[model samples]
Target: MTMRSTMLLLAPAVLGVAAPALAQTAPTILPDATVLEVSAEGRTTRVPDVATIRAGVVTQGQTAAAALSENATRMTRVLAALKQAGVAQRDIRTASVALSPQYRYAENQPPAVTGYQASNSVSIRFRDVAKSGAILDALVAQGANQIDGPSLSLDQPDAALDEARANAVKIARARAELYAKAAGLSVARIVTISENGANDGSNPQPPIYAMARAMKASESTPIAAGETQVSVSVSVRFLLK
Candidate 1:
């Protein structure tokens, strides 16, 4: 084939590939479109449905074996009381078990071993927050000496987060339209959407501090499941014309 024929044959193939490349690189936004990016946050509050608490027994004795034995006995009773109170076995998880020596410090002398302290703790989840206080009293009655926390939260947060996300988008669009109107322009369309983050803004209650002998026998500990806030932030790009 002549050189001129070879050149003609390759020209169409080169043009075909170049055409698509140009199309891919072409600007998506119209020349008259003005880009406006707005960030907005939306929040909603709901009552917490779950409560988590830590309950434990602490005992001291002259020997590690004695201390551990006493702690085990008390913890057994505590677990039984939780069962009697209708707490599910899956909700009762052992948090910790430890035995440590108690030391007596002396001036200019080696620290003397005084006694051994044994502790056993379990984390309990209460589906019914209203009954948690009464159950706590029962646990104490069964020899749970150390109690901490009734941290409240939502069991399922996906629906609440979705609601917040919708609100954020609404706010962003409203704000963008306001900006457009202020500039004597009308909103053309949304260019893009990006989510910044989501957070659970729960107003946590103060941890409950209870001892076996602190409260009166007739009064059950009171629990209040305060409302928790769910928030979502979004960035939206709108075109104005």
Candidate 2:
């Protein structure tokens, strides 16, 4: 090849390799500006609107078949009472069903099978917090011997969490502005924003376990639906000039 033609071909190849390096060198942020990172948290509270409870029947008999049969009879009545109380079928779910042999222990002898115990339980969700207590009482009267929990939670938490997130950003920006002012500068712009921890607070509290008994006509179970807190934390980086 001629010397001029060789030089021309080499120039294009050199330009191709240099183009990507020039693109990569472009600055993402102002090189002369000071970078400040700040973190802040925000929280909001709302009253719980949903409650979860478990109701079950426990029976003991000489044989497993008898124990299960007796448990089924009582459980059927419990389910019926729940339905009559306006509980939706979708809100009711079988939690557990167990059949185990009872054992007797002697000082010098091995354990002996004494009887059989059978249990059946269902988890129930109450959309109306105020009316759940009355419904719970009816469940006990309908033969629910083992009753557990009224775990309180919010039915919807997305709106509350969004509110908290906005508050977090506001707080983070305020903090960055304060720092910039102390350093004799002003905040130019936000360089980066990242969420640290976002909590919806929909998780239920520890449940209350109780053995329910028949109550008088004027008495009913008491359930308190307290406030739940939704919180968010954010880390923000600001460029100061």
Candidate 3:
């Protein structure tokens, strides 16, 4: 074909491709709309039914083997005491074990290894919160040197969380209704629902200084457990009519 006729045939095909490209590159214009965001919080309180304590043995010796041996012996006694106190074997678990060199630092000098320290920790779950204090004291007498936490919790946290969730939904609906009335709009339907988080508000009780205190040869340690709280938060979007 002649060059002029070939060029004429190609022009329409090129224009067809360019038209779609231009349409795709075009910016879209959106209509004006208002967005409303709201947050709701809810809380539920319950007397804690269970308690967890973290206790351990720490031993230091001139050699790693000696330190570890001493720690193991003490931990054995602690475990035995826990079992005797009615703590189930399944509820008691070894959380951590470590043997590390202890260093003694001197002014303007490289530190020297002074001794070896061995630590073994066990986490104990007490189903009966009332007996938590006594359990702690018993463990201390049995040779637990390091006591970290008694983080109070619930055995069945799901129930409490559900109650809190229901309360949260109620709170959100109330707030949304109030806002809708103020804006002269009616509730249409729920657009979205989301959970921010849920938690058992069991604060870690202060570490008991039971290990440091000198106990009478025959005295039993006294312990106390306070109440625990559970909380939940949710975000819901309701379409306005």
Task: For each candidate, give its TM-score against the true structure.
Answer: 0.81, 0.82, 0.78
Give a tens-digit lDDT track for model 2, residues 1-241: 0000000000101111111121133226534446777767778888988888888889999999999999999899999999999999999999999999999999999999999999999999999988998998887888888878877777788998888877877877777777778878888876556666776767566666667654866967778887878888766666677
Going through the candidates in order, what is the number of backbone clashes in each? Answer: 0, 0, 1
Q: How does each model score on lDDT?
A: 0.78, 0.76, 0.69
lDDT (Cα, 0-100) at 180 in candidate 3? 73
Model 1 error, position 227 (Å): 1.6
Would you give me the overall lDDT of model 3? 0.69
The Cα error of candidate 3 at residue 64, in Å, is 1.4
Residue 8, candidate 2: alpha-carbon lDDT? 8
- lDDT (tens digit, per residue) of candidate 3 on 1-241: 0000000010111111111121133222122222233456667777777777788898999999999998889899999999899899999988899999999999999999999999999888888877777777788788987776667777778887878877776777777776777777765555445677778667677775435346565645444565677777676655555
By lDDT, is 2 or 3 better? 2
Estimate the TM-score for candidate 2: 0.82
Error of 1 at 190 (Å): 2.5
Candidate 1, lDDT over the whole model: 0.78
Ranking by lDDT: 1, 2, 3
